[model samples]
Every structure is written in C-alpha cells, then in structure tokens.
Target chain A: MDRSGTMLFADLLGRAKTRIMADWSAELERANARVPGRVSTQELVAQGREVLELLQSAASSGDSDPTSAAYSRLRDLLAEMSRARAFQGFSPTETATFVFSLKKPVFDAFRTEPDLSPDAMSAGLWTATTLIDGLGLFTMEVFQKSREEVIIRQQREISELSTPVVKLWDGVLALPLIGTLDSERTQVVMENLLQSIVDHTAEIAIIDITGVPTVDTLVAQHLLKTVAAARLMGADCIISGIRPQIAQTMVHLGVELNVVSKATLADALALALQRIGRRVVSASPAPAVRASA
Target chain B: MDRIPILKMGHALLVTIQVDMHDQLAMALEEDLTARIAATGARGVLIDISSLEIVDSFIGRMLDSIAAVSRLLDARTVVVGMRPAVAITLVELGLSMPGVNTALNVERGLALIGVSVSGDGEHDAGTEV
Candidate 1:
C-alpha cells in the first residue's frame, strides 16, 4: 500500500492492459484470416473468454483502464460477431462472455454519469444496454441483487406472460402481461400475441399488465400496437391493469393514447366477453389486483 | 433476450402480431423473432394491433419491411396492431401499418392461419414464472 509501490503497480496494470487489448485485436485479425471471410460463433465466443480472463486478473490488480479497455474491445467485437445467430449457445465460456458484454454497458453508464438518481440510473442503464433474452443481465451492484425478489412479488404477472392460451371461453384467447413491458419483452409479447391471434383466430385478446411497475413511453407504444394490429384483423385487444403511476407517466410524457380502448382486467374481461357475445358469470366485483405485486 | 425458439423459427413462415413492440432491446427481438417466424413456413402473416401505445413511422416501417420479406417468400401479410389512438396518429402522420394481416387478438388472428400451434405454450421469457 506504499504510495510509490501503489503508483508503480497501477502503471504496470495499465501497460499490461493496453498490451492485452492490442494483442486481442491482432488475434481477431488472425481469426478472420483463418476463416477467410466470417468468424464462427465459437471463435468469437472463445476469443471473448480469453479477453475476459486476462482483463479480470488485471482488474483484480487495480487496473481499471485495462479492464475497461478490455470491456470496450469485447463489446465492439461482440456487436460485429452478433451478425451470426449461431453464436448463441450455452457454452459456459460463451455465456460468461455474453454476460460480460451485456453488463459492460451498464458499467459504462455508471462510469460516465456519476450523478444519476436511482430510478434514472436503472432506467438509463437498462435503456443503454440491450438485454438479449439468452444473454444474462446480471449486475455486480448490490442494489439489483433483489431483482429476483422483484420478480417474486410479481409472480402472477410473470405466470401470465408464459401462460399458454386455454379456451377459457369458446372464442376468447387471453394473453397476460404480468411484468412491466420493456421494449425487448414487448417484442416477444407482440410476436406471441399476434401469433396467438392468428393461430387461434381469436376474437378477444386480453393483455393484463398487473405486474408492471411502471409504464413509460416505450411500454405505452407497445400497448398501442397491440390494439391496432388486433383491430386490423377485425378483432379487439383489451388492455387491462393500468397502474395509476403509469397513467400519470403517460400524461406527463404528453403522449395521448385516447384512441386505445384501455381498462382494468375486470373491464377488459367484461368487454371481451361482450364482443364474443358471451354472458359472464362474475357480475360481482373482481378482487383487487395487488398494487405492489 | 432469450430468443432461442424464435431464432430457431426462421423464414418462409409467418405469424400475426398486435403490438408496438420497440426499444433498444427490441432490435434483438426483431432479429430473432423475425428469423423464427420466418422459419415456420408461414407463407404469409398478419400483425393485429389494437392495444399498442404509439405507432411512429420507424416502427410502422419496420413492420412493413418484415411483411415485405415475408411476401418475397410468397407469404401474404396483414399488419394488424392499430389502436384508435395510433390509427388517428398514423393517419395524421400519413403512416400505415402496411403489408400484414392485423387483428384484435388471437381469435381473428388465427383465422388467417395455415398451421396449428402446439398445445403446449411457450412461456420462456428468460425469467421464471
């Protein structure tokens, strides 16, 4: 911990990191040469792990720049390699590399904006990095450790998302939107819902977002698309479970969604049943949806 | 982000969609989902959206491109996600959902189909249910 010793160590770490990065770039060129045009997913992923191991050890020795540089280089490399879908596999090393690539954006966000609020920070970080479904969005920060807990509270929402459509009624198909809709999930939701519509030839699609914590502009837009696409097919998509905060966020954002027919799940159900010309059994008020849950 | 099956479901197949699903993360979704939907041998598709929040030109165009590619495979298309708010906005903005069969949800959505969905549902969203 001596000042000179510490300073010398830091310098050495920096030089070593720079060297590793430079060497990695050279390795990439060699990899491309070996392939003659395209690098296989294995090569990209394997190279990614090599870079991570070197950087991680260097990181352990108080070398932020090299660690950061290694991360930057890896990010660029992955983006380029991502052109091929075959690179997506559960190889432990590849998985680790993908995780590193995903998280690096969050880390960079923090490093760049040292003065972000908690919510803004999370959203900023979330928005900055794309979360690929197979790629893990793990956080080293203590705060996000309870993300699993957050999902737990919203189990109903979570369940509904993965829930397969059963003909609850003769003509009704339901899609439960349990969690908040990020753009990525929204795409999945859009694909699933639309496919279900065509597959089932559904007349009623219920998107219940009771699990969503907030509704930002992106989420709102996803909702809008659902309703529109449904109408084009001569069916109706009812969106239930609009959290008050989300309503407020929509208003605050000055985005008008007056044309979309939105209501609570109770209302969505009633409307859907009516559209299908079916009589409902539950005229009694439905139980209150969990606000936190 | 786990688009395992979606990626596996590549071109010539098409399915309908009904939402304005977009964001930085959506790019990956489009890449994988489009690939997978194409794999299904749909020969046509329809995206019904009456629940979406916004339908800007960029998203509208993305839908069009997706449908156009599906068309090249001789797969017909109908863009279905069109909430009233979005429709009005799109009209005002001079945009269209373009080239896909859009419905309200699965009922009208599936009526256009050529294949049957497996009884089992796909619930994998990378998070446990």
Candidate 2:
C-alpha cells in the first residue's frame, strides 16, 4: 500500500531475478512434464523472464494493485499467453501454472532479506501471493473464452459441410440430409438446395431423409418449408427415405407432408424420372439375347 | 415512370421484368396487366423475374394479387425464372403466393399452358383447358 513497502519488494525481485526464474522453471517442469515437447524449454524460459520483468516494473511504480495502470502490460501479456495455450489444448490448471509457479521462488527470495523486520517480510509475502493469484485467475478466464470460440467456429463449419446438394440426373437434384433438422441447419439446407436448383435448372428435387433420426413436428415443419421454397424456385421436391417408424410418427402427429414422398431413394428417383417424362428400361431384352445366342 | 413491357407470345402474355419494381411501377403493372388480359383474352400469363434480385413484402403481395386477378379473368398465371434469393425471401416473408403457378423458364411456362415450344404459328398454340 505504501511507496516504501512496494519499493522494497521491487528491489528484492530485481536483485534475485535470475535465481527466481531458475527455480520457477524447475517448478513448472515438475508440474507439467507429462506433456513432452508441448512447449520448448527456451520458449518457457523466455515467457517466464518476460512475466517477471513486467511484475518488477509494476511493483517499482509503488502500486500493489494488479488492476491498476502500472500492471496493465503484465495483465495483457498473461491474457495473450493464456489464449495461445488454450488453442494448443492446455488444461486450465496447466495454463494457470505458468503464473502460480513463481510464488515459491519469489517467497523464498523474500525470506532471505536480512535487513527487513518480520512484520514487513510477512506484509511483502502477502502482497506477492495475492498479485500472483489474481494473475492466475485472469489467465484461466481468457483460456475458457478462447476454448468456447473454437467450439463455435467448428460448429459453423460442420453445419456448412453437412448439407450437400447433389445433381442426381439432368433435371433432378437429391439432397441426402444426414442429421437432426435444427433451425440453423435447416436454413443451410434450404439455401443450398435453392441455389442448386437454379444452377442445374432442376425440375424435381428428392430430399432423402434416411439420415434423420426422428420425425417430430418441428422437423416436419422444417422439411415442408424446404419443399415450399424449392417449389417457389420452380422445382418440386420429393421427400424420400421415410423409415417405417418415422411414417408411423408422422401419422400420429397429423403432420401432412403434402409433397410426394417415397419409401426409398430408388423409388423417389423413379417417380422423379417419370414426372420429367422419362423412364429407365433394360438395354437388352431376355428374348433378344436368346435369339442372338 | 417507365412501364414494364408485356409481349404477346402465342395464346399467353409474357412480361419479363428487367428493372426493379417500385411501388408505383408495380401498381401500374397490375392495372395494365388486368386490362391487357381482358382486351387480348389470353389464357395464360408468364412473368419472367430472373433479373429481379430484390423484393419486399409489397412486391410479394403484388404477385399474389396479380395471380388472383388473372384467375378471375380465367387466365392461368405462371411466374417463371424467379431467382433463388427472391424465392427464399418470399418464403421468409410468409407469402407463398398460392394459386400462382411457377415454372423454371419461359419455355416451361409455355408448355404448362399447352403452347408448343417449336411451333411457328402462335395462333394455333391455344390454351389447353
């Protein structure tokens, strides 16, 4: 709190900086040595040295409050280091260990100050402990935030990748949906199917829901919206792959998928072909083959 | 206000929207289309909106009304060549435009109305119904 007390702590830290850093590195290695090569020894030493230098400067400014302007640089550096460790998949404890490991080495240095009275030594130790603990908590906060951001980004990518519109024939498109139909995924599915309809000039789109696990009201509504959107783009949709259980559920729920639906993808393809005024026939008739032989 | 031109193709009236439809223009088109349908006695109306990129709720309602008016006049309205974005917007706006038949292009629209695509004599391609 007072200028003289902070000055004494900063002075001790600067004098014994090397000894403190050496002991801190040994402590960190013992705590996190199981994850070999996760961080190189040289990088660890450099990061430890940087943190110590910032702490010494902050203390020399006569401010023991970690949230003060004096400790701003140290706070920012710790937050940045924690974010990097989070992306590298470090646990919260491992990320905080980078800051907490300095507690023992610095306290040991303060213990050997011969000119200091016992009361002043204890006061200095209290300030050091609180400062390091505050920084460790700040580091963990940033780590948790970065991990959540990674998860959100991956979720967006997966949703985009899941809905793929394939052109089954010259005038038909098949969208084989393979996951639960959430609102977000439904939006993606609708956009992809409409764009493909325009590109291929498709007259019929077969939405095969073999991958959908259930047929609830919400899921049925989403499918109907998709079919309606395709119709607006001048393409009719054929919902195929209605499992027996899903059909039963649809009946029970009174959900009418007024669009033409088929029991299998192949049957839907046949109907689509028929609507387009085409049909698949065998290339060689059995009677013709026997006559030729 | 520049008017959206309407062309007579066979027994159908073809209106290709090349400019953005403002409120006034859309209103003008509605009146003009109804009058033309009455005067020409055409049995089908094909609206090509492939170049139309933007539409709000007003345009959506206008399309619905145009279809309704044409139906009263005993003419089948088939809106053709709507862009993908426009269709998505219409769906989101909850204006499905029921009773308005949609086709991918002018050729399909003609086929829907029983107008032969390759026939040279437009008069012979009468309404199917």
Interface RMSD per candidate: 10.9, 5.0
Candidates' C-alpha lDDT: 0.50, 0.86
Give the per-residue lDDT of model 2 (tens digit) for B21-128: 999999999999999999999888899888999999999899989999999998888889988788888888888886788888878778776643235334332111
lDDT of 2 by residue, A1-293 (tens): 45566777898898999889899888877876767778886688789999999999999998888889999999999989999999998888888888998899988899877898877887788788878888888888889999999999999988988799999999899999998999989989999999898889988899999999998999998998888888888888899999999999999999988888899999999988777767798887789778899
lDDT score, candidate 2 = 0.86
- Give TM per candidate: 0.34, 0.87
The numbered model that scores best in DockQ is 2
A1-293, model 1: which lDDT tens digit per residue?
22233233333334444443444445544444544434454565465556445434443443233224434543444433432322322233333343444344334424455454666555433422332221232222112333344556576456445645444465567776655666556556666665666566666677777777777777777777755655554455666777788777778998665443455767767766665556666666556643445
**True-vs-predicted CA distance for residue A14, candidate 2, Å:** 1.4
Question: Which stretches of candidate 2 lie above 4 Å from their native place?
Answer: A2-5, A34-37, A40-43, A67-69, A286-293, B115-129
User: Per-candidate TM-score, first chain only?
Assistant: 0.40, 0.89
Q: Model 2: DockQ against the native?
A: 0.39
Instruction: Rate residue A110 of model 2 by lDDT.
Output: 92
* The 10-residue segment with the lowest total lDDT in model 2 chain B: B120-129
- Candidate 1 — which residues are off by over 4 angstroms? A1-167, A259-262, A281-293, B1-129
After aligning candidate 1 to the native by TM-score, how far in Å is the CA of A19 from where it should be?
37
